[model samples]
Target: MRRTATGLLVVMAGLFGLARWMEPAYPAWSFVRAFAEAAMVGGMADWFAVTALFRHPLGIPIPHTAIIPNNKDRIAETLARFLRENFLTPIIVSRRMQRIDVAGAVGRFLADPVPGGRLRKGAGRLLADALEALDPERLGTMVRGGLVAQLRRLEVAPLIGQALAAAMTDGRHRPIIDTMILWADRTLDANQVLIRESVAKRAGSLLRWTGLDERLANAILDALHKLLAEMAADPDHPVRAKSEEGMAELAHRLQHDPELRAKVEHAKEEILDNPAISLWWQGVWEQARAGLLRAARSPDTAVAGFIGDGLRQLGDTLQREPRLAHTINRFARRATVGITTGYGDQIVRVVSETVRRWDTETLTGRLEQTVGRDLQYIRINGTLVGGLVGLLIHTFDTLI
Candidate 1:
């Protein structure tokens, strides 16, 4: 459209110039003819210059004409090279970024309540979307494959034994032993009737063998009950001491003995290899996922409050601590530098490759649409400015 309009203007000016030169006129008419002729010359000159950029004027095969289409590859290469040299240079980027004062800008934004709220809301929405997009089954499989399976393969028995040994050495297991003893005592005391019944049954068998009566059986039952009562009452009894010694010996063996450790490891492997273990793990994961999903879905949930509090705390810390802020900024800058340094070529390649893939005609059309209006002004200005220059030259030539 622009090219067509420019061509029409040029043609109109040419015709007007021819009309002026062919017909001689009076002084006023001559002055008008001079201005019109000069305007035509100015318009024609500008038209050729503009046309020569994209194509040869009037289809004439001129050098450097249609420069863009003929040398598009060179143009792309030059653009890429220019970006790599100037815009992507570390010093240039750093200076430009520093001038922007990104940290100060971020701080100011975070300090503003409305902007901060909006930022928080945006972050929350992003997080929610991410969470929603996550597949629970896939996540479970990854956890099982990556973490649980790895843990199952690890030798945990040695560590567990070492910890047990430490606990025993520190007398941490003593309370457990005391509690067991107390529980056993209470159980025995509560089952006195069962104890008596068992004693009576044993006594009867002995009487049948010794040819005694029910009185002897009754005496034997009473003696057995007394013995049990004494055992329960006495904390320092031989039974209690033996039980403690047995537990201590077991702990020592578990820690010092390789055989014991191997046995424990074998048992652990057996448990882990069991289908029940996997089912249990899957159940627990499902419950946890369900709980989290429920909490996230609820608007008035503690999870939301906790997240809000965490964000607020982070914002506060970033604002209050200058060293922290500097560290974050320095880290961000270093990361940016690393990416640009390490993958700069790749980035340029991607841009060039993408541009090369685009249909040239479509690309040209889109570019024109975006900046064509502004470029039209150039033609208009050229016409106006050229006419003025032409008039000045004509006047000067006549005067000389």
Candidate 2:
């Protein structure tokens, strides 16, 4: 195309030269001479205009010529401004984003198993990377520090009291009280001889001298066993009721009594202050970290399976719930607007800065490569238009 445009210009110049020579030989050739002269002039003018856009004509400096190379910075700034004002403006960006069903699109992407799987795998890889990057020993120390900090905030006594209270609700603690009683009764039965000897020794010289020590010890042991059995057999036993009443009082104290709460807090402080408390937590964390590391490496591990299932469930939720989808889309829209409004200008400046950093010659060559062929067409149009105008002027002159 460039060759064609250039060749047309050359041919027009040659034709004008021929017409100039033939004009003197034949008067009728004046019209041909006039057309060729105008065409040659028009072609040259367009050639200069096009050349000036990218470079100086014939390497000679002219005002506003070499427009692209000389005004590179100005051109970049203008382009950048145009983009910022017209394309990246909040209104324009928001409008474009509003056209998209952001969450629905995401839901569709997730519903397609391929993309969902890819997303899941990507998340897993990220998790694996994070796990791999951590030093287990350091992680344990961090865990220990975190645990101690958390434990310091806790009052174990109140928690236990509250737990007991909750357990006692609706007679839930009755079975526990029964079990305690039964265990105590069995212990007495199992060690009857040991209990007898201990009681007889405590009986002092009076019982031993009476020769009634063995029978008396037996009677005492049977009475104690019978009492234990009574406690176990009767849920409404006085001891059981007393125990429940004591627990209820303790729970109320934990919840409402300031002095008891203070004691609980003091105990919490003691536990946290212990040096070995940190070590215990560190050990626990190390064990958990080891298990996690093992789980991450195994594809068929429960943790991996759980993660996969969670991802699928999330995808399914997105697909099924329109309200959730809308909420997600609303968030996305707001985020998009915020980013565009906040940093859009700076982002646009990247274009101008990049252009400014480009070498002049390189920029000029690239511009010319992109638009040179189109500029050649302008030359062709000029030649044709100029010839027709010239012919009209000649005919009007002849008529006058």
Candidate 3:
């Protein structure tokens, strides 16, 4: 294309030479001479304009020539600024993200099974690689830290109070109370001989001689059994009422009593500090990690199948529940907007710095490769248009 454009310029120059030489003998040659003159001027001017974008024309150091190479850093900054202000802005990104169904897209991606179950296999392998790449000790430490942080943030007293309150409200506490009572009865039955021996020891010598101690022991046992039966059969028994009231008071104190709440908090800290608990938790973590690693590595494992089923179920839920999808999409949009707002400046800086680091030759080559052809056409257009205008001017001059 460049050669073609340059060739046209040569042809116009030839015409101009021919016309200028013939104009002395023929008046009509003057019009051709004028057209060719204008054509050469327009073509040369456009050629300079085009060449200046990539380099200095004819290798001369001219002001404003080699526009792109000389102004590369400025161009980079401008480009980065443009992106930050236009495309990377929070408002623009948020608005654009509003129309995107992020959760729906994720649902479709997860739910749709690929040929030969390759997607699941590929995902498993990817996860396996990621897990293998992690340093086990560091990962364990991070996991432990995260768990501790969450635990520290949790208000244990209020949570326990709420749970206890909920259990009572739903009448679930009755079964627990009944189980405790049954256990107590079994314990009492198991220790009956010990109780009888204690009664015998406490009895006087006269009572022991008449076998009155045995009778007293039996009578005490019978009365205790009857009382237990009464308590078990009567829902409105005083003992049961007292127990319920004590439980209610404890629940209330767990939530509202500062002293009790502090005690609970202290107990929580003690539990966290316990070596037994720590060892148990460490064992659990190791087991869990090992299990996850196995699952990730083996696509056909039960754990892997369970994970796949869970993901499919989640995808189905997302697809079926528009409200959930919308909520997820909203969260995604907000998260994206936050990232854009936070890192946009750094992103722009990185872009500008990358461009600034490029050598002039590379930068010039890239820009020329992108838009050089269109610039050649500009030269061609200028030559033809200039020639036509010159012809019209010549005709007007003759008529006037």
Candidate 4:
């Protein structure tokens, strides 16, 4: 830039000198003098104007000179304000987010097997690291606290009552009762010898002496068998109905009986208070953590495979479901707008603070590097235009 400016000045000076030397020999030298003289003045004026933007020209302290360095703070503030108000506004951010197809983009990314695999691997590693970092005692405490809170909130007796009621609905408990009765019948049939011995021991001396205890035991066994058979075969048997009525009464008591509920609740508390349950829970956690760590380390991990498959499935669904995509867009827009709106002031401060940290020398040097060449062109234009205008004036003066 300096070289170009110097070259133009040299050309102007040469023309002026030659014109002055040739003025006596040729009257047309006057036009050359006018154009060159005017051009030289124009170039100098442009050079000064351009120089004054960055610094005081010739080291002279002039009003509004060295504009960039003097008003750097104001410029920084204005720039920061402009960006905050216009570029980073909630409306602008929300609109931009609305235009972006985040779900579709995510779906496309997840659908790619290579990237999906990488993501799965990365998640596995992170999970493994997290598990490894957990302190056993701390984790135990946390789990205990959570479990205690949940237990405190739960009414165990009512829950159990409801579950029992549900299980008894639609004759569901009948099959269980039938199976129990069958087992009892088989037991009575198999234990005949024991039954006969008991019967003989309980019999009078005469029956024992005549060995009629066996016959009696046989009769009792036959009666028991017949009763079981009848209960099993006859759906409307009196015993079956009585048993069902008893079960219904129990279910209703469990659901509504305050005393029964209290007893149940006390039993539950006792079970939980037992050290064995705590030990069991701890064991469960340890086993789960160990398995999770192993799965995370191994390539054949169910969690990672599930994650990859789920991502692909989600992506496919989103691609097919326009309403789902729109829902995602709405959520994304809301989040973006919320973040921008909440942090707008901070963002503005960041810009201003960054600018404020820059020293004058560094800022000026950078600005010069970026736009110095362009400013030189302005100087060249000024010089050429000034010269043309000067020539026109000179011509008009001569003609007049």
Candidate 5:
């Protein structure tokens, strides 16, 4: 483009030379001469204007020339400041985030089944890399230690009390009572032999000889079963009412009774002090580490499948539940706004610093690549436009 524009200028100069020589014999040649002269002036002016942006015109140390290279630092600062003011502010980020449904986009991405399962594989690889970064032994020890510290600090009695209080508030305790009754019935069935043995031991030799002890054991089992059934069937049974009262009292004592709280704390300490618990944790940690390592190694198939299913399920749930999706979107927007608000200065600093670090040639070369073509066209336009104006002026002169 530069060569083409320069070539046009050279052609104009040649035309001017030819016309000036011919004007002695032909008056019409003067108009051609005027046009060429004007074109050369316009072309040179535009060329200089374009060249001055990148370097000194004709290699002379012209003032206001090489504008970009000379003011590189200032340009970088201005650019960064522009970004900070217009793009990185919280209001800007928040507005942008409002238009973007981050959660919905993520859900769709996760749910979409790409060719060759690329999304699932990418997620798996990411998970594998994260797992590989952690030393399992160290992570396990840290986790166990943290758990112990947390448990030590935790007041179990109060936590349980709060849980019971919450459960009782919505009549949730009824389901628990029902479950306990079912389990009690199962326990009786399981311990029938023990019950029979106890009955046999308590009975006299005469009753045993007549098989009366067996009948007595049967009766005892039936009565216990009947009692459990009654408790299960009748929510307002005397036993259930008494049990609920006992639970309410227990919840209160757990929260307020110092003696009971101390006993619960002591029991917790004993559980922590038990060597069996340590052994159990060690076994659990080892199994978990092995399982994770195995999954990480073959995540493309194993972990990916599980994760992909979960993602699809999550996406389906989000798609089904507008409220959940809205909540997630709100959280995403808030999080994005927070990040922009917190790190905007640093981000702008990075932009400025990056631009400032570039050498003059590199900076000039990049800018030229971006806008140099349009600038060359400007030279071409200037030449054509100038020639037409000159022709008009020559006609005006002849008319006058």
Candidate 6:
């Protein structure tokens, strides 16, 4: 189109110039000469206006010509301002967004199983890549440095103590306590011979001090065994009850007493400071991290299947529940708006900076190559329209 327009303009200019030269020789072609001259003038004026936007006409450096190259910065700034004012303004954006009914469109798209499957697959791949790229060591370090440090600085002992007190009061740990006691009893019985030998060795000095006979030591050992057996047999024994009571009292004090709270905090600090404890924690972290990485990397793993199944179920739920879908869409839209609102200026700056960094000549050349053909139509239209108008004017003048 641009080529055709330019060619027409060039042809008209030549014809007009030729007619001017031939007018004296052929006086009968005066109407044709006048029309050609008017056409040429109009073509040239339009051509100048259009060419001035991009470059100097015929390599002549006219002021305000080559506007794009000379004032590209100002142009870009104006373009950006225009975009912000006309398209990106909050009210305009909101109105456009509301008219689109984006939530409904999205919901309809997701309702289809095929599209939903594709979405899920894409999301899964992204999630897997993201998870795989995450360096557990870095994550652990961050958690340790930021979260753990913050947690350590916080006074969490009182909260923990209160939770413990509640558990104890509700007899949540009774079964554990009973199991431990039973295990202890069985262990003591298993080591009775060793205990008896150690007792005998220690009793020799005691016997000398008290002037007690060997029979007395034997009787005392038998009595201690009997007591252990009785305590083991009766779960509701005074000893067990007293132990439970002591534990409950300790928990209560830890929760309610300031001194106990301080003591708990001190213990927490000690644990956190200990090298052995840190090593233990690190070892546990490494094991858990290795397990997670191994599972995530294996496509055939149950963990992957479980995750996929859960996602499928969630997708199904979203499809079934319009309200949930609406909520999710609304939340996502708001989140998008929030991000754009907060970072839009930065985004614009980045774009502007990148554009500014480009070689102007190269950019202009590329743009011309892409769109120059279309601009030619304007010149062609100018020539045709100008010729018609000139012909009409000449006819009207002849009649007058």
Worst 10 residues of 2 by lDDT: 295-304
The list of candidate 2 runs beyond 4 A from truth reads 21-29, 113-321
Give lDDT per model, in order. 0.66, 0.81, 0.88, 0.84, 0.90, 0.69
| lDDT value, candidate 1, whole model | 0.66
Give the range of the ten consecutive residues with the poorest summed lDDT in model 6. 295-304
In terms of TM-score, which candidate is strongest?
5
Name the runs in model 4 displaced over 4 angstroms: 112-313
In model 5, the worst 10-residue window by lDDT is 295-304
Each candidate structure's TM-score, on Cα atoms with residue i matched to residue i, is 0.53, 0.52, 0.65, 0.53, 0.72, 0.54
User: How well does candidate 4 score on lDDT at residue 229?
Assistant: 93
Report the C-alpha displacement of residue 121, candidate 2, in angstroms: 11
Residue 198 lDDT (model 1): 68
Q: Could you give candidate 1's per-residue lDDT for residues 213-253 as a string of tens digits?
A: 45564565566556555655675677657866887677677
State the lDDT at 106 in candidate 5. Answer: 69
lDDT for model 6: 0.69
Task: For candidate 6, write residues 1-400 as lDDT tens digits.
Answer: 6667778877877777777788799864556766776777777878887788788999999888987788767766776666666765555655565545455555454333353354545555565676568887776666567855986888876677677777777878677677777777677667767765665677768675675645665676677667656766786878878877887787677668898788778887887888887677778778776665554455344223665466556666776787886777667667656766777677666656665666778657766777676656666677787887887787788779
For 246-279, candidate 3 gives per-residue lDDT tens digits of 8888889999999998998888888877789767
C-alpha lDDT (0 to 100) for residue 284 of candidate 1: 88
lDDT (10s digit) by residue, model 2, range 1-400: 8788789888888888888888888977888877877888888899899989988999999888999998999999999999999988878878888888887776665444453254545665676678779887887777777777787777676788778898888677888888888888888889989987887888869888886788887898889888888888787888778988987998889988989999889877887788887778777787777666665555344333665577567777887898998888878888998998999989889999999999999999888889888898998988878877887798789889
What total of clashing residue pairs does each candidate reach?
Answer: 0, 0, 0, 0, 0, 1
lDDT of each residue in 252-309, candidate 5, tens digit only:
9999999999999999999998999988998899887777666656654553577658
Off by over 4 Å in 6: 13-31, 96-134, 140-309, 366-374
Ranking by lDDT: 5, 3, 4, 2, 6, 1
- TM-score between candidate 1 and the true structure: 0.53
Q: Write the per-residue lDDT of candidate 4 for residues 1-400, one digit (tens) a residue.
A: 8679868977988998999899899989899989998998899899889989899999999998899999889988999999998989987898788779998987776666453376767877999999889897678769877996788667777776676678778667878789978998999978988999899999999998898887999999999999999999987899988987887788788879999988887887887788988888888888888877887787344534885578678878888899998999889889888889889899899989888889998778888899999999888887888788889999999999
